[model samples]
Target: MPADRPYDRRRLLRDAAVGAAAVSTAGLATGVPARAAAPAPAGAPITAARARRSGAVSFRWWGTAGWRIDIGDRTVLVDPYLSRYDTGLFTGRFNPDTPLTVDAARIDPLVDRAENILVTHTHWDHFNDVPHIAVRTGARVVGTLTAYHLGLAYGLPAGRLAPVKGGEVLDFGDYTVEVVSSLHSRNGSWSLAFPGVRVSPPPRPEKISDLPEGDTLAYQIRVAGGPSVFFTGASDLNERNLTGLTPDVAMVASAATTSTADYVPRLMAALDHPKIVVPVHWDNFETPLTNPPTVAASDRERLDDLIAAVRKASPRSRVLLPEYHTAYHF
Candidate 1:
């Protein structure tokens, strides 16, 4: 099992968790800190869509901690739990719905055309509607063993869903994807938080019949010419996790509650890969507040704390605090 609580791990994870003190570029700007891009070759601005597609990876946020990546001509959607389900899911547990402002509809188009869907885990908010999507879009689903099984449970064919083991890669004709591991608990169902508070309540004691909710997971995908992208669903940073891959861009969960709050420094440290850092799993829910076992106020404060820590550790990396519906090129 992972350490009961992180120790040196904490110290390392906090590399990006520097307090509000001034960061010393200290001449390392040329190193992992800042890499100057070569001058853009002058060319007529062609069709913007073609320009956008020319990028090695086209990434966009689809609410929550989910992302859409287009590698060359292959399109991959990760952890899309798009729903305006009841807010009662988060009310009293996490932070309140203080969204960073992005449209969900814009994300809908991408989902409709996704060629492949990879769920990092099985959380309702991450895997929702995915089964139907796979059926509708003819997209293959790849993820952790459990994720593949979860898709199977939703009526997906065994052939359409591939169970990925860490260190292995799945090729989609246009690109490749790899499944990674994480130390998150699924025995405990997934829950939402509202500003260090519970914005919603839990299912009735009787309705608690649904087995544990979801598990967290990580992923690595490589496109023909794009740098590899690493995505962590959520977990306490583990050294064993940094294996078999070099991430050119990494996306990790930043749910402002117990898990994210406690492990920010450590997790980020283990992911000290020099690349683009994208934040996911923030404060956003569509349901009305009315649930049990909600977030205890203490957990809500974790989000702000994690963000602060990241500011310190990764001042060198471009931090993308994405809006729900915008596209980013990597």
Candidate 2:
């Protein structure tokens, strides 16, 4: 294998373990208090005073497929997987069948202010940290029935868990969130790295890998009188579901190795081409959070391809490459 291939499982697991331990210890030593403000219901109007108090919608990327969106007095999270796991030690080997090994201390700071959590699927990286975040922040957890069961197993209060099978439009006071049915990327060299799997409900499994991809979803979040944003955690898209949906900003996953070769253009066309596109999930996940993001030799090419595709398909769309932990106001 090339030295900079970036998917060396053994090396990734080893480093992740060490990094997780350090983060856990540090987080325990200096944990931030969870915010007490509750999230407003969808469709709630954003008054001028409230808008001035909260300013414009701000988005912060938390590595992997996690995003923190703050609008008015409400904060919503999408596919937050801040608990870096040491997947190299799983018994299932390449499969994601492993017990949840979340670094709670590490995740506390990122989720302290969140009032709502939206999960795209039940994959380890997209859903692992959600239970902890919900419990800590008193945020509503929204997703498939599988995700709700996982939350229940993780001890989340029933009231905080909202189960859905897509096609739900929620009113959160200052913003409206629409849940659209979506599809996970195919399992192949240029798609999701693991086999596409789903877990049965009623009794949540003890292992993380057992947590299946119940149902994939994409979120079209429209802030009252503010920018509308669309989020897709996986590379695949259901064109019919997204047709006629035009968002001002689109956060598209850019992991080339785990995506179809032409995902970018297809996604762009499906959403009617947004004005701004942000490439996310392009960073190597196995690496530690404290370390700077590393673009694998192969990923660099994939990113270039994505950019070219975006330009060709949507010439007017501005592609923004976000830095980790940095907030982008829209």
Candidate 3:
């Protein structure tokens, strides 16, 4: 069980932090807190188009909380950040002024078919490539009001962005999406980086810090007569909002530190112990999305802890650590 409600942000931050020698940099500038990239074993690439006709849903991880979910002929993307440009995040020298970039050459191939793009927050890693992808694919960008404002600031057409404040069950013929109000993962200080919301359109974001947290959210994509998948862009979640979700697959994020109360265990129970738990946002985001995904030396232990906790909490659930671009069918 988790600690009592009404947490003490400052106290937790102080207790969770190690001395300067072993400082935990979780939820640092990149909002991933303290993740490092190390290589992961390669997974077999299984593309099953024919399986789609039988109500099979295909899922592909785009690294750092991004996913490509295919339901029949339509495609839905969640926090799809494929640019993976260098930001000095994992290099021990964090740079807040890193310029925002778009790698069309890389993103073009993966995102050209998306019909709907879900934004979990306005953080740079999650939202940087959204505008470009939405414009190119003409997909509807659904997220918070701040995400909508950021989309407009990025020159995305008003009609192309849909502002949702959770509790919206949108039917898209072959599937439906349920938006849940959520929270961003806290840093070692029990605070978030670049925290703030833009109620209205703000200046165009040029550098990474220019884009604020703008709040966070989680998404549940339910395929018609098939499987339901839950995606979280940040490690922390709103337990109250997750009740009764009971997804077939849950793409849970790994915590950078132990700030949240029993992060993994509480989530597994709240979601009714999903049949499959796919851990996301665990790899090194600064590195390119290639075979053998990278994890930092320190992050290796954190990733193991997350997996172990999931297994203990839900012994029957299968925990799948995703490899970049590898297809998974449920």
On TM-score, the leading prediction is 3
Please, what is the whole-model Cα lDDT of each candidate in the order they appear? 0.51, 0.67, 0.75
lDDT, candidate 3, residue 99?
Answer: 93
Give the true-structure RMSD of model 2: 8.4
lDDT of 2 by residue, 1-330 (tens): 432444433222211111112222122211221122333333564562465355545777787678888775468999988776666532223434557777887887666577789998887888878877887888999998878777877778789989888789999767888998987765333334333443433465566656677778889988777778999887677788887779988988754343345677778888888888877766656556654454444335556666677888988777776656655665
Number of the candidate with higher TM-score, 1 or 2:
2
lDDT of 1 by residue, 202-239 (tens): 23111111212244457777665556778766544455
| Model 1 Cα shift for residue 43 (angstroms) | 22
Off by over 4 Å in 2: 1-54, 89-98, 189-204, 255-261
Task: Specify the highest-lDDT model's number.
Answer: 3
Ranking by TM-score: 3, 2, 1
TM-score to native of every candidate shown: 0.65, 0.79, 0.84
Off by over 4 Å in 3: 1-56
Indicate the worst ten consecutive residues by lDDT in candidate 1.
6-15
Candidate 3 residues 31-56, lDDT tens each?
Answer: 22111232221233222343344433
lDDT of 2 at 301: 59
Q: Where in model 1 is the C-alpha error above 4 Å?
A: 1-53, 93-110, 185-215, 255-262, 287-301
